[model samples]
Target: MTTKNVRPKFLNLFRIHLPVTGVVSFAHRVSGAVLVLSLPVVVFLFALSLHSEQGFERVSEILQCGWVRLLSLLVLWALFSHLFSGVRFLLLDLDIGMRLAAARASAWLVLALAALVLIALLMGVLL
Candidate 1:
Protein backbone atom coordinates (compact mmCIF):
# COMPACT_ATOMS: atom_id res chain seq x y z
CA MET A 1 0.00 0.00 0.00
CA THR A 2 1.17 3.55 -0.85
CA THR A 3 1.23 6.16 1.91
CA LYS A 4 0.26 9.78 1.31
CA ASN A 5 2.81 12.46 2.16
CA VAL A 6 1.86 14.91 4.87
CA ARG A 7 2.74 18.57 4.72
CA PRO A 8 4.50 20.38 7.55
CA LYS A 9 2.13 21.83 10.12
CA PHE A 10 4.19 24.92 10.81
CA LEU A 11 3.31 27.78 8.48
CA ASN A 12 6.91 28.86 8.15
CA LEU A 13 8.63 25.53 8.29
CA PHE A 14 8.23 24.83 4.59
CA ARG A 15 8.94 28.39 3.59
CA ILE A 16 12.38 29.89 3.06
CA HIS A 17 13.04 32.07 6.03
CA LEU A 18 14.01 35.71 5.54
CA PRO A 19 17.55 36.51 6.47
CA VAL A 20 18.40 39.04 9.19
CA THR A 21 19.03 41.74 6.61
CA GLY A 22 15.43 41.50 5.45
CA VAL A 23 14.20 41.91 9.03
CA VAL A 24 16.43 44.93 9.64
CA SER A 25 15.38 46.49 6.35
CA PHE A 26 11.73 46.17 7.24
CA ALA A 27 12.33 47.53 10.76
CA HIS A 28 14.25 50.51 9.42
CA ARG A 29 11.28 51.80 7.46
CA VAL A 30 8.94 51.28 10.42
CA SER A 31 11.29 52.99 12.86
CA GLY A 32 11.76 55.87 10.43
CA ALA A 33 8.01 56.45 10.27
CA VAL A 34 7.80 56.44 14.06
CA LEU A 35 10.60 58.97 14.27
CA VAL A 36 9.02 61.18 11.63
CA LEU A 37 5.70 61.33 13.44
CA SER A 38 7.37 61.88 16.80
CA LEU A 39 9.56 64.67 15.45
CA PRO A 40 6.69 67.17 15.25
CA VAL A 41 5.54 66.69 18.84
CA VAL A 42 9.06 66.58 20.17
CA VAL A 43 9.95 69.78 18.38
CA PHE A 44 6.76 71.44 19.49
CA LEU A 45 7.50 70.71 23.13
CA PHE A 46 11.08 71.73 22.62
CA ALA A 47 10.04 75.04 21.13
CA LEU A 48 7.46 75.63 23.81
CA SER A 49 10.00 75.18 26.56
CA LEU A 50 12.38 77.55 24.81
CA HIS A 51 9.75 80.31 24.85
CA SER A 52 10.30 81.11 28.55
CA GLU A 53 12.36 80.14 31.58
CA GLN A 54 9.34 78.77 33.44
CA GLY A 55 8.38 76.67 30.48
CA PHE A 56 11.92 75.38 30.34
CA GLU A 57 11.85 74.46 34.03
CA ARG A 58 8.52 72.73 33.65
CA VAL A 59 9.71 70.67 30.74
CA SER A 60 12.89 69.88 32.63
CA GLU A 61 10.87 68.58 35.55
CA ILE A 62 8.77 66.40 33.26
CA LEU A 63 11.92 64.97 31.76
CA GLN A 64 13.32 64.10 35.16
CA CYS A 65 10.87 61.25 35.73
CA GLY A 66 12.17 57.69 35.28
CA TRP A 67 9.33 56.80 32.91
CA VAL A 68 10.08 59.81 30.75
CA ARG A 69 13.74 58.86 30.61
CA LEU A 70 12.86 55.32 29.58
CA LEU A 71 10.56 56.57 26.87
CA SER A 72 13.24 58.90 25.56
CA LEU A 73 15.75 56.08 25.49
CA LEU A 74 13.30 53.91 23.53
CA VAL A 75 12.80 56.71 21.04
CA LEU A 76 16.55 57.04 20.74
CA TRP A 77 16.82 53.33 20.05
CA ALA A 78 14.27 53.52 17.25
CA LEU A 79 16.05 56.49 15.71
CA PHE A 80 19.41 54.79 16.01
CA SER A 81 18.11 51.58 14.44
CA HIS A 82 16.64 53.46 11.50
CA LEU A 83 19.79 55.47 10.93
CA PHE A 84 22.07 52.45 11.08
CA SER A 85 19.84 50.27 8.93
CA GLY A 86 19.50 52.97 6.29
CA VAL A 87 23.27 53.01 5.94
CA ARG A 88 23.26 49.23 5.65
CA PHE A 89 20.64 49.41 2.91
CA LEU A 90 22.67 51.97 1.03
CA LEU A 91 25.66 49.68 1.18
CA LEU A 92 23.53 46.80 -0.09
CA ASP A 93 22.25 48.96 -2.91
CA LEU A 94 25.85 49.58 -3.84
CA ASP A 95 26.24 45.77 -4.19
CA ILE A 96 27.74 45.34 -0.77
CA GLY A 97 26.95 42.35 1.45
CA MET A 98 25.75 40.36 -1.52
CA ARG A 99 26.80 37.12 0.09
CA LEU A 100 24.63 35.39 2.69
CA ALA A 101 27.27 35.42 5.41
CA ALA A 102 28.10 39.06 4.78
CA ALA A 103 24.46 40.07 5.00
CA ARG A 104 23.95 38.24 8.30
CA ALA A 105 27.15 39.72 9.71
CA SER A 106 26.11 43.20 8.66
CA ALA A 107 22.70 42.77 10.28
CA TRP A 108 24.34 41.79 13.54
CA LEU A 109 26.62 44.80 13.21
CA VAL A 110 23.65 47.13 12.81
CA LEU A 111 21.98 45.64 15.90
CA ALA A 112 25.19 46.02 17.86
CA LEU A 113 25.56 49.60 16.75
CA ALA A 114 22.01 50.39 17.74
CA ALA A 115 22.56 48.83 21.16
CA LEU A 116 25.75 50.80 21.62
CA VAL A 117 23.97 54.03 20.76
CA LEU A 118 21.15 53.27 23.19
CA ILE A 119 23.62 52.46 25.96
CA ALA A 120 25.58 55.61 25.34
CA LEU A 121 22.45 57.73 25.29
CA LEU A 122 21.28 56.18 28.55
CA MET A 123 24.66 56.99 30.07
CA GLY A 124 24.16 60.63 29.07
CA VAL A 125 27.10 60.48 26.69
CA LEU A 126 25.08 61.47 23.64
CA LEU A 127 21.95 63.57 23.28
Candidate 2:
Protein backbone atom coordinates (compact mmCIF):
# COMPACT_ATOMS: atom_id res chain seq x y z
CA MET A 1 0.00 0.00 0.00
CA THR A 2 1.15 3.53 -0.75
CA THR A 3 2.19 5.42 2.35
CA LYS A 4 -0.40 8.05 1.56
CA ASN A 5 -3.17 5.45 1.50
CA VAL A 6 -1.90 3.49 4.50
CA ARG A 7 -3.71 3.69 7.80
CA PRO A 8 -3.29 1.90 11.09
CA LYS A 9 -5.51 -1.18 11.34
CA PHE A 10 -5.97 -0.61 15.06
CA LEU A 11 -5.69 2.75 16.74
CA ASN A 12 -5.35 2.15 20.46
CA LEU A 13 -6.43 5.12 22.48
CA PHE A 14 -6.30 3.26 25.80
CA ARG A 15 -2.69 2.21 25.22
CA ILE A 16 -1.58 5.81 25.21
CA HIS A 17 -1.93 7.56 28.54
CA LEU A 18 -2.54 11.28 28.67
CA PRO A 19 -0.95 13.48 31.27
CA VAL A 20 -3.15 15.08 33.91
CA THR A 21 -2.91 18.46 32.18
CA GLY A 22 -3.83 16.87 28.89
CA VAL A 23 -6.86 15.22 30.41
CA VAL A 24 -7.92 18.48 31.96
CA SER A 25 -7.59 20.26 28.62
CA PHE A 26 -9.65 17.58 26.90
CA ALA A 27 -12.34 17.80 29.58
CA HIS A 28 -12.44 21.56 29.19
CA ARG A 29 -13.37 21.28 25.55
CA VAL A 30 -15.89 18.53 26.25
CA SER A 31 -17.61 20.51 28.99
CA GLY A 32 -17.83 23.57 26.76
CA ALA A 33 -19.40 21.53 24.00
CA VAL A 34 -21.89 20.03 26.42
CA LEU A 35 -22.79 23.47 27.69
CA VAL A 36 -23.40 24.77 24.18
CA LEU A 37 -25.59 21.81 23.26
CA SER A 38 -27.57 21.91 26.53
CA LEU A 39 -28.20 25.65 26.44
CA PRO A 40 -31.18 25.35 24.12
CA VAL A 41 -32.87 22.76 26.28
CA VAL A 42 -32.27 24.88 29.39
CA VAL A 43 -33.76 27.91 27.70
CA PHE A 44 -36.76 25.94 26.55
CA LEU A 45 -37.34 24.63 30.03
CA PHE A 46 -37.07 28.10 31.50
CA ALA A 47 -39.50 29.50 29.00
CA LEU A 48 -41.96 26.73 29.62
CA SER A 49 -41.80 27.22 33.37
CA LEU A 50 -42.39 30.92 33.05
CA HIS A 51 -45.20 30.79 30.49
CA SER A 52 -47.99 29.63 32.82
CA GLU A 53 -48.72 28.27 36.27
CA GLN A 54 -49.45 24.80 34.88
CA GLY A 55 -46.20 24.93 32.91
CA PHE A 56 -44.30 25.91 36.03
CA GLU A 57 -45.84 23.02 37.99
CA ARG A 58 -45.03 20.58 35.20
CA VAL A 59 -41.43 21.74 35.05
CA SER A 60 -41.07 21.54 38.82
CA GLU A 61 -42.56 18.06 38.89
CA ILE A 62 -40.22 16.84 36.19
CA LEU A 63 -37.26 18.28 38.05
CA GLN A 64 -38.32 16.43 41.19
CA CYS A 65 -37.64 13.08 39.50
CA GLY A 66 -34.44 11.39 40.68
CA TRP A 67 -32.97 10.82 37.24
CA VAL A 68 -33.63 14.38 36.23
CA ARG A 69 -31.90 15.55 39.38
CA LEU A 70 -28.93 13.37 38.56
CA LEU A 71 -28.83 14.72 35.04
CA SER A 72 -29.03 18.23 36.37
CA LEU A 73 -26.06 17.51 38.60
CA LEU A 74 -24.11 16.38 35.58
CA VAL A 75 -25.03 19.56 33.81
CA LEU A 76 -23.95 21.50 36.86
CA TRP A 77 -20.56 19.79 36.76
CA ALA A 78 -20.16 20.63 33.09
CA LEU A 79 -21.01 24.24 33.78
CA PHE A 80 -18.53 24.53 36.64
CA SER A 81 -15.85 22.67 34.69
CA HIS A 82 -16.28 24.93 31.73
CA LEU A 83 -16.23 28.00 33.90
CA PHE A 84 -13.09 27.07 35.84
CA SER A 85 -11.22 25.83 32.78
CA GLY A 86 -12.13 28.91 30.85
CA VAL A 87 -10.68 31.02 33.62
CA ARG A 88 -7.55 28.89 33.61
CA PHE A 89 -7.18 29.40 29.88
CA LEU A 90 -7.60 33.11 30.31
CA LEU A 91 -4.80 33.15 32.86
CA LEU A 92 -2.60 31.23 30.45
CA ASP A 93 -3.38 33.74 27.76
CA LEU A 94 -2.12 36.47 30.07
CA ASP A 95 1.19 34.63 30.58
CA ILE A 96 0.15 33.27 33.96
CA GLY A 97 0.91 29.65 34.90
CA MET A 98 3.11 29.23 31.84
CA ARG A 99 5.53 27.00 33.69
CA LEU A 100 4.92 23.27 33.37
CA ALA A 101 4.46 22.74 37.10
CA ALA A 102 2.19 25.74 37.46
CA ALA A 103 0.09 24.63 34.53
CA ARG A 104 -0.33 21.14 35.95
CA ALA A 105 -1.16 22.50 39.38
CA SER A 106 -3.75 24.87 37.95
CA ALA A 107 -5.33 22.06 35.98
CA TRP A 108 -5.71 20.04 39.15
CA LEU A 109 -7.06 23.08 40.93
CA VAL A 110 -9.66 23.62 38.23
CA LEU A 111 -10.80 20.02 38.39
CA ALA A 112 -10.93 20.16 42.18
CA LEU A 113 -12.92 23.37 42.10
CA ALA A 114 -15.46 21.84 39.72
CA ALA A 115 -15.80 18.78 41.91
CA LEU A 116 -16.32 20.95 44.98
CA VAL A 117 -19.08 22.84 43.23
CA LEU A 118 -20.76 19.60 42.20
CA ILE A 119 -20.55 18.23 45.73
CA ALA A 120 -21.95 21.40 47.24
CA LEU A 121 -24.86 21.37 44.80
CA LEU A 122 -25.64 17.73 45.40
CA MET A 123 -25.59 18.21 49.17
CA GLY A 124 -27.91 21.17 48.89
CA VAL A 125 -30.45 19.18 46.96
CA LEU A 126 -30.07 15.91 48.82
CA LEU A 127 -30.06 17.30 52.32
Candidate 3:
Protein backbone atom coordinates (compact mmCIF):
# COMPACT_ATOMS: atom_id res chain seq x y z
CA MET A 1 0.00 0.00 0.00
CA THR A 2 1.10 3.57 -0.75
CA THR A 3 0.21 6.80 1.07
CA LYS A 4 -0.77 10.00 -0.67
CA ASN A 5 1.00 13.28 0.13
CA VAL A 6 -0.99 15.31 2.65
CA ARG A 7 0.83 18.59 2.39
CA PRO A 8 -0.03 21.39 0.01
CA LYS A 9 2.54 21.84 -2.76
CA PHE A 10 2.28 25.58 -2.67
CA LEU A 11 0.86 28.16 -0.33
CA ASN A 12 -1.49 30.82 -1.67
CA LEU A 13 -1.67 33.79 0.67
CA PHE A 14 -4.40 35.57 -1.26
CA ARG A 15 -6.75 32.63 -0.84
CA ILE A 16 -6.37 32.48 2.89
CA HIS A 17 -9.14 34.06 4.94
CA LEU A 18 -8.13 35.44 8.30
CA PRO A 19 -10.55 36.32 11.08
CA VAL A 20 -10.97 39.91 12.16
CA THR A 21 -8.78 39.45 15.22
CA GLY A 22 -6.05 37.98 13.11
CA VAL A 23 -6.30 40.89 10.69
CA VAL A 24 -6.05 43.37 13.51
CA SER A 25 -3.04 41.58 14.96
CA PHE A 26 -1.35 41.52 11.60
CA ALA A 27 -2.12 45.21 10.97
CA HIS A 28 -0.75 46.11 14.37
CA ARG A 29 2.60 44.51 13.52
CA VAL A 30 2.72 46.08 10.07
CA SER A 31 1.82 49.53 11.35
CA GLY A 32 4.50 49.22 14.02
CA ALA A 33 7.06 48.49 11.34
CA VAL A 34 5.88 51.41 9.24
CA LEU A 35 6.15 53.78 12.20
CA VAL A 36 9.60 52.51 13.13
CA LEU A 37 10.90 52.78 9.58
CA SER A 38 9.46 56.29 9.14
CA LEU A 39 10.86 57.64 12.39
CA PRO A 40 14.15 58.90 10.96
CA VAL A 41 12.38 60.77 8.18
CA VAL A 42 9.95 62.26 10.64
CA VAL A 43 12.70 63.40 12.97
CA PHE A 44 14.73 64.81 10.14
CA LEU A 45 11.79 66.80 8.87
CA PHE A 46 11.01 68.06 12.36
CA ALA A 47 14.59 69.19 12.91
CA LEU A 48 14.73 70.79 9.52
CA SER A 49 11.53 72.68 10.17
CA LEU A 50 13.10 74.14 13.31
CA HIS A 51 16.59 74.85 11.94
CA SER A 52 16.19 78.18 10.04
CA GLU A 53 13.89 80.12 7.74
CA GLN A 54 15.26 78.39 4.65
CA GLY A 55 15.04 74.99 6.28
CA PHE A 56 11.44 75.64 7.27
CA GLU A 57 10.57 76.69 3.76
CA ARG A 58 12.29 73.64 2.31
CA VAL A 59 10.42 71.35 4.64
CA SER A 60 7.15 73.01 3.74
CA GLU A 61 7.87 72.64 0.06
CA ILE A 62 8.74 68.99 0.45
CA LEU A 63 5.52 68.36 2.33
CA GLN A 64 3.49 70.23 -0.27
CA CYS A 65 4.14 67.64 -2.95
CA GLY A 66 1.18 65.40 -3.75
CA TRP A 67 3.11 62.21 -3.16
CA VAL A 68 4.46 63.52 0.10
CA ARG A 69 0.95 64.34 1.30
CA LEU A 70 -0.19 60.82 0.38
CA LEU A 71 2.75 59.32 2.23
CA SER A 72 1.95 61.50 5.22
CA LEU A 73 -1.61 60.19 5.22
CA LEU A 74 -0.37 56.62 5.10
CA VAL A 75 2.05 57.23 7.95
CA LEU A 76 -0.68 58.87 10.01
CA TRP A 77 -2.99 55.92 9.39
CA ALA A 78 -0.28 53.54 10.49
CA LEU A 79 0.19 55.56 13.65
CA PHE A 80 -3.48 55.39 14.59
CA SER A 81 -3.82 51.74 13.63
CA HIS A 82 -0.86 50.79 15.81
CA LEU A 83 -2.10 52.89 18.70
CA PHE A 84 -5.68 51.61 18.77
CA SER A 85 -4.69 48.01 18.23
CA GLY A 86 -2.07 48.26 20.96
CA VAL A 87 -4.73 49.40 23.39
CA ARG A 88 -7.00 46.53 22.35
CA PHE A 89 -4.15 44.07 22.87
CA LEU A 90 -3.44 45.49 26.31
CA LEU A 91 -7.05 45.00 27.28
CA LEU A 92 -6.95 41.45 25.95
CA ASP A 93 -3.97 40.79 28.16
CA LEU A 94 -6.13 41.77 31.12
CA ASP A 95 -8.77 39.18 30.18
CA ILE A 96 -11.08 41.66 28.56
CA GLY A 97 -12.82 40.84 25.27
CA MET A 98 -11.72 37.26 25.45
CA ARG A 99 -14.99 35.86 24.21
CA LEU A 100 -15.10 35.12 20.50
CA ALA A 101 -17.84 37.61 19.75
CA ALA A 102 -16.29 40.31 21.89
CA ALA A 103 -12.89 39.80 20.33
CA ARG A 104 -14.31 40.12 16.83
CA ALA A 105 -16.24 43.22 17.82
CA SER A 106 -13.22 44.84 19.33
CA ALA A 107 -11.15 44.08 16.24
CA TRP A 108 -13.74 45.72 14.01
CA LEU A 109 -13.93 48.63 16.40
CA VAL A 110 -10.18 49.16 16.20
CA LEU A 111 -10.29 49.17 12.43
CA ALA A 112 -13.22 51.57 12.40
CA LEU A 113 -11.54 53.93 14.81
CA ALA A 114 -8.37 53.95 12.72
CA ALA A 115 -10.42 54.64 9.59
CA LEU A 116 -12.25 57.50 11.34
CA VAL A 117 -8.91 58.98 12.31
CA LEU A 118 -7.71 58.73 8.73
CA ILE A 119 -10.82 60.54 7.55
CA ALA A 120 -10.33 63.26 10.12
CA LEU A 121 -6.70 63.64 9.09
CA LEU A 122 -7.70 63.91 5.45
CA MET A 123 -10.27 66.58 6.21
CA GLY A 124 -7.80 68.46 8.35
CA VAL A 125 -5.18 68.38 5.61
CA LEU A 126 -7.54 69.27 2.80
CA LEU A 127 -9.32 72.12 4.57
Best prediction by TM-score: 3
Better of 2 and 3 by lDDT: 3
The global Cα lDDT (0 to 1) of model 2 is 0.91
User: Tens-digit lDDT track for model 2 on 8-126?
Assistant: 78989989799888988999989988888889989989999999999999999989999988778878899999999999999999999999999999999998999999988878877
lDDT of each: 0.85, 0.91, 0.97
Error of 1 at 125 (Å): 7.1
Candidate order by decreasing lDDT? 3, 2, 1
Q: Give stretches of model 2 more than 4 Å off.
A: 1-10
Q: Each model's TM-score, in the order given? A: 0.78, 0.90, 0.94
State, as a TM-score between 0 and 1, how close model 1 is to the true structure: 0.78
Q: Which TM-score value belongs to model 2? A: 0.90
lDDT of 3 by residue, 1-127 (tens): 9999999999899998999999999999999999999999999999999999999999999999999999988899999999999999999999999999999999999999999999988888779
Candidate with top lDDT is 3
Model 3 clash number: 0
Give the Å shift of residue 67 in candidate 3.
Answer: 0.3
